[model samples]
Target: MKLPRMVYNQPEVVQPVRTDVLIMSPWLAPIVWDGTYNLGILNAQYRQRKFRVGITIFAIKKYTVFVKKFIESAEKYFMVGQKVTYYIFTDRASDIPVMNLAEGRSIAVLKVPSYPRWQDVSMRRMEMIRDSSHTRFSHEVDYLVCVDVDMTFNDEVGVEILSNLFGTLHPGMFGLPRDSYTYERNPQSEAYIPADEGDFYYAGGFFGGNTEEVYKLTNFCHKAMMVDKEKNIEAVWHDESYLNRYFLYHKPTKILSPEYLWDDNFGIPAFLKRRRFLAVPKNHDEIRNRR
Candidate 1:
């Protein structure tokens, strides 16, 4: 069954309460941090050093158009003044469009073999990232962000999102109970999560952390996927299932609100006053099934 669309409208002004400012998850962990950050302070602290931020995205074949849009939007709204390098992994690097970049921002194309199945493309991302970290990424950047190509930065996604480890709350599952979350439930699979335990179902499409931590995460997920493959068992959501299991045992240092990965197709929720990034609507069947 499809979930209801989260809706939002302006609220009436009221006297502020100290308790009202605190953002907590159902498990009572400090998961969401919307108003708690000061962007000016964060930007001032990180921009001075020009922190080397690496963004990794895959745009194999037909998805190149989405990458083009992502690059244009990211330059305008994502960490605008920071030192950022987009490590674009694609089969056809020549398809990447040329765009003007701000000072301290640039792009590098990494050629990856094309996969026939979308599931293979999704699962292989973890392995490729882990391999790339050791060979190329480790020597190039301070932090690494793995994100889907079909998304665009809608607002300032600045230093506030950075940490030792970070995960974005899935827009569709953020409000649901743990049991209702679409986690891999089979015990036989490496990505299983019991019904009684979970903090949040993080979106696999957007996540990042310190260079070392992200490398470890990619390595861990790759190993887990290999184990599942040996048993001929694929999790319900492919790599996403493994990611949920990883975050369960190894909690993220920070949890980004749904604002970071809202779907443009859904109406804004009242709690999400500002949307930092938006998933561009696309024909999922065409993109995933064409092969």
Candidate 2:
């Protein structure tokens, strides 16, 4: 199929789009940033394909409060002209606010069980998504994006982000050396990574790929978590740690710059020219039931 006939900026072979930052990983995966690619061109290609995307998020217990704003913001800024299904996994599906979705967009809430501790809830998300991949997503969507429910879209997160496999750089860990990354160090845990070895600290909050690839990612992550549990050892950041381990070996086909996952605390560094998805500040003590 041909992309929509349209006129956009002409490409320049000698002119690199992003010179201030690393636009490509050592392994050659594209590191997506503000000036890296033309969104208009990418959108036309995906629009012609009429591909469907399933964005998965878990809002168990009190986290359900964030669902409304996230959904409303996504409707406005995410893949505006494409088909999307917001696959919301929430304990309080009834509490999710009702809003009129755009053309070719819809919401599907799967009532999930609530856990007492927030960590357990976070860890279980892998299994939940892993289970849904075959049961719901494979049949309905071409791509599956998994994100943390506590965040909201701050700008356009469109088809330019879709790929066979992709992961976002953790805003807090951006530009930090690999040794400084907070990887799970325990030799026994399946998520372990030696201090000297690591590529990038990927944010589990926003990661995905085509349904087939995402299914393998979730399956491996969920299984690793189970193995750790059997040994009575939990990875430092639970699912996030396991996710980092996954990427350490299976490099993402596309790596999203910190722009895709930012926190206000970072104060918008020069490289982070555009902020897309941002963290919604919350009192960890109150929301996560921390001591």
lDDT of each: 0.84, 0.90
Write one digit per residue (lDDT tens) for candidate 2, span 248-288.
99999999998899989879787778899999999967877
Q: Considering every candidate listed, which one attains the maximal lDDT? A: 2
Candidate 1 lDDT by residue in tens digits, 125-210:
99999999888888989899899998898887888888888898998887789999999998999999999988889999999888
How does model 1 score by TM-score? Answer: 0.89
Instruction: Note the clash tally of each candidate.
Output: 0, 0
- Model 2 misplaced regions, further than 4 Å: 1-6
Kindly give the stretch of ten consecutive residues in candidate 1 with the minimal lDDT sum: 15-24
| Number of the top TM-score candidate | 2
lDDT of model 1, residue 229: 95
Query: In candidate 1, which residue ranges exceed 4 Å CA deviation?
Result: 1-33, 48-50
